[model samples]
Target: MSGIYIHIPFCKQACHYCDFHFSTSLKKKDQLVFALAKELQLRKDEFKDTTIETIYFGGGTPSVLSTNELQYLIDSVYLNYKVTDHPEITLEANPDDLIINNIDALSISEVQSLYKTKFEELKKTGINRLSIGVQSFHEKDLKLMNRAHNAIEAKRCLETATQYFDNISLDLIYGIPNSTNQEWLENIQTALSFGIPHISSYALTVEPKTALASFIKKGIIDNVDDDLAHDQFHILIDQLNQAGFEHYELSNFAKKGYYSKNNSAYWLGKSYLGIGPSAHSFNGKQRAWNVKNNTIYIKKINQDQLPLEIEILTKNDKYNEFIMTGLRTIWGVSLTEVKKQFGESFLEYLLQQANQYINNQMLCIVDNRLKTTQKGKFLSDGIASDLFKLR
Candidate 1:
């Protein structure tokens, strides 16, 4: 089975730490939507033989689109691709879009009631899942991140959203500057109290050129604490494990029945088609990404050309990826599969590289599969890189 990821590269406002390809302007929204539909049609042949099991609307903020506008693209996917009877359709939304927040104009009950109404309308549009961007519930932290939603919308949206959707995932951020371990614990508790089935939490990294980086450089904001982040990560793991959410992957936790199919497909190396600006698509042998600039992407698509460049994976590239992704999740890298797929040479090289870590107890093998041990989970990426084969 395959999946489709449609990127909506527009946001109501820019988050200070975000470097994702997006614009705060909505002037070209309609044209971009039209172009995305056209792009889908153009790339239909790529997935003609596969049944699409998931369709993810990820972005700057998918909630900016009206139900009808969103549906037009979903309809396009159905019209073009072979789809399963039940497909997981997810929309990534910010709290502000999900709830109409004029707490003064309406009572808390009235405001939350409106959220239910809006979410109900969204549900009817065939979206089976909602991924809420509730970065933080503290007003100070929210202001620090420059997230559009305030503390009220964050809590209010969850309280109301749970009423409409069962397959909900909340995105939370840890390690924000000035956020203490206590505050982080409270955030995790607040999320658990919502009874959300899935959470995709991440550390606050300052990517180059983002406002967070600039702020740190200029001494406007305090730098993030690595020790604090380490402490908070354990707090999350302990609390979530106690709450029965599986730490299925790094930065992700899910209840037994609530794993993210869209994300799981990516980690498991399943084929997926990505449409719109800055979206990436991968067939087994090759990968492609759309142009990052909206104007260029629209222009190229309008001219009947795909704006993305392509990369054909070498055997080494594929092998390295398998090891990296495998080690990140609960599923470890299978030496048996490696030997079968890439031959004994690659497998031997992997075992040779892994010997040191395995001896150190940072990793262990189960049934010939390599996975990170508890002490190594936080540094899985670095470990994975060290084991990469040089061609």
Candidate 2:
């Protein structure tokens, strides 16, 4: 099944470690939404009647938009695309936005609880799922990362959310310099305690040009230790497994039935359309991405041209992509499918390279499906790259 992704390219504020495309300015908000609607209509024929099973509103922060803005955006997609009867529509939001105003809203918050009202409105307008960015539950960690939400807000938001929506996913980051093993375990425990069904966790990396990277260069912040990160990665996997969560992808875990349909579709190589600034789309044979600059993206779409770059996948490119995404998931590459799709030579190349890994106990073949051993999971990307065919 295919999906749609709409990038809301604005945030209330920037987190120190974030490098995603977003602007703190709201001046172009209305124009950007209108432009996204226009882009959606213009590209309607790209997928050409494919039934969309999921529509994800990813971002800077979709929750920053008012109900009216969100409603209009969803309506526009419905008007333009043929959506499935029960599509999974997810919105990525932060915790701070869900809380009532810092003051006396607590009395009102205790009355009907504003978080509940917000979820009701969100669901009424077609948001069926939420991917909340609850990066940490430790006050010190939250402050170090410059996150807007406090630890209490993170806990409250999820606890309150169970009253309305059950299809919720969360994000967690590990291996921060200050996070100890015990602290990381507590973080995962806290998340599990919330009963969230799906979780996507990642090791904190200091991307160049981000504030965290500059702090390290200035000696104001310590650089991340690879060994510590690796230690914590194993800890995360073990903890999740013990908790009965399936380690579905290299960085994602889920309860049996709560795997992310949108993300799963991506790993399985299904087609999806991405709308709005800095979004990427892949339709099996080609990939396209919109401009990262919000102003430029809005201007181009307002003038009736999609601000995107297209790449037609070569045979090698396609094969490498399959290997890269396939090897990361629990569902590894199928030798039979590879042979049928790519031909005997490429399949032979895979089998040849896989021999060493197989012999070394890093890769295993069960019923013609090649999967990574538990030890190889952490180094999956490197192994996949080693097996890739050269042009």
Candidate 3:
């Protein structure tokens, strides 16, 4: 089965640490939506024979779109592609946008479209899943992160969404400056108390050009310590493990049978299509990414040309990608799959490098699969890089 990811590139405000492709302004949203619809039609051949099992609307904030806007886009995909009967459709939303009582003013009719629309009517649009961005449950941390919603709103929105949707996932950020290990544990427990079936939590990283980066440079905000992040990551893993969650991907945890099918397909190297600015698509042998600039994306798409760049993966490229993605999850790398897919010579090369790691107890062999030890999980990125095959 295949998957589709559509990025909505608008946000009410920018988060201090976020580097995602989102605009604080909404000037081009109407044109951008139309452009994305056109792009979906143009790329229909990309997923030709594959049945789409997941359709994710991720972004600056997908909930920002009105029900009619979202339906128009979803309708385009169904008209052009063969999708599963009960595909998992998810929208990345911010808590502030979800309070049912506040949508009257924020409704899509604000666009005063050639046609009228209302954002509050989204539930009727067949969008089956909601992934809310509830970064912290503490007001102090919310202020530090400059999130649009307070701690009360964060929890309140979850309660509200539960009334309409069952497939809900909450996004949480850990390792914020001045947040002690105990506080982090409390955060994990708070999330578990919500009884949401899925979670996608990540360690806070200070990317370049973000306000966090500049504040740290100016001594106004303390930088994130890798050691602290590592320590808290351990706390996170242990707490979630005890709560009966599966550490499926590196940062994602899910209850039994509730793992994110869309993300799992990504790590498994399944073919998928992505539409919108800064979106990426993969087809096993080649990868493509749309332009990161919103203005340029709209301009190019208006001309009936996709603003994307493509790369054909070489054998070495494919091999390195496998090691990097494979080792991060609970599923270890399989030697049999490697030997069959990458050839005997390459398999031999892998064994030679892996021997040292196995002997050092950083990795172990179980059922002919090469898996990481507890000590190896934190340094997984470094190990995966060492095992790369150079061209």
Candidate 4:
């Protein structure tokens, strides 16, 4: 089965640590939405024979769009492609966009009714899942990251979201500078308190051009401590496991039967089409990405042209990707599949490189599948890089 990823490249404001391509201005929103639809029609033949099992609305902040605008884009997909019945449709939202304002005069039940009305409208758009970006539940952390939503909005959103959507996922950031392990633990507990089924957490890495990186460079903010991050990651795993969530991937924990189908398709190397600026697509043997500029993207699409670059994957490139994605999940690299797809030499080379990690108890072959040990889960990416067959 395949999937389609729609990139909504607009946000209300910039976050301190984000480097994703987006515009804070909404002046071009209408034109860009139309362009996205046209591009889907223009590329219908690419996935003509593939049944799309997941439709993901990802972005700078997909919640920035109105329900009608979102439905328009979803309708565009149905018009051009063969989507499976009951496909998993996910919209990535920010807490501020999802919550309702509390007017002092309005009763608590009246405010809740407004929230219900809002999310019900979203449900009508065929979005069955909501991935809310609740990076932290701490007020200071929100300011440090320049996230648009405050701590109150984060908690308020989840309180109502869980009442409406069954398949919900929330994001958390573990390694914020100066954040104590206790604070990190509190974040995890706050998320669990909402009964959210899936959680995707990551370290707060300083991307090169983002504001966080510059702040650290100027000594305005301290750099993220790797040692502290390591401690918190383990704390996260322990807390979630005790709560009966599966640590299915490096940064994702899910209750049984609640894993993200869209993201899992990506890790499994299934073909998918990424629509909009700065989105990436992979069709097993090849990969493509659109230009990162919104104006240029709309201009090109209006002219019935694809403003994207494509690359045909070399064998080593495919093998390296498989190894990288494989090691990060509970499902490890398959020795037999490697031999079947890449020949004996590549398999032999992989085993040869992996032998060192295996000897150190960081990796082990169970049922002929090479997987990282619990001790090595945090280092899977570094280990996978060592196993890559460089040309």
Top TM-score model? 4
Pick the lDDT winner: 4
> How accurate locally, in lDDT, is each candidate?
0.92, 0.89, 0.86, 0.95
The TM-score values for the models, in the order shown, are 0.98, 0.97, 0.93, 0.99
Sort all candidates by lDDT, best to worst: 4, 1, 2, 3
Error at 344, model 3, angstroms = 1.5
lDDT of 2 by residue, 1-391 (tens): 6998999999988888999899999999999999988998999998775988998999899889988899998998889888889999998989887666564545754746566677789889999898999998999888878888999889878877767889999999988987899999999999999889898999888987888888889999888988888888999999999989999999999999999999999999999999999899999889999999988998898789989999999999999999999999999999998999999999999999989999998899888988999988888899999999987
Q: For residues 1-391, write the lDDT of model 1, one tens digit per residue.
A: 9999999999999999999999999999999999999999999999988899999999989999999899899999999999999999999999988877556877868876676778878888899999999988889999999999999888878888898889999999998888988999999999999999999889899899999999999999999988888788888999999999999998899999799999999899999999999999999899999999999999999999999999999999999889989999988898899999999999889999999999999999998889999888888999999999878
Task: Name the regions of candidate 2 deviating beyond 4 angstroms.
Answer: 103-113
Model 3, residue 247: C-alpha shift (Å): 0.8
Per-residue lDDT of candidate 4, residues 123-219 (tens digit): 9999999999999999999999999999998998898899999999999998899999999999999999999999999999999999999999999
Full-model lDDT, candidate 2:
0.89
Q: Candidate 4: lDDT over CA atoms?
A: 0.95
lDDT of 2 at 326: 90
Model 1 stretches astray by more than 4 angstroms: 106-113
* lDDT for residue 316 in candidate 4, whole number 0-100: 99
> How many pairs collide in each candidate, listed in order?
0, 0, 0, 0
How well does candidate 2 match the true structure in TM-score terms? 0.97
lDDT by residue (261-347, candidate 3, tens digit) is 898888887888999999999888999999999999999999999999999999999888887888877787888989999999988
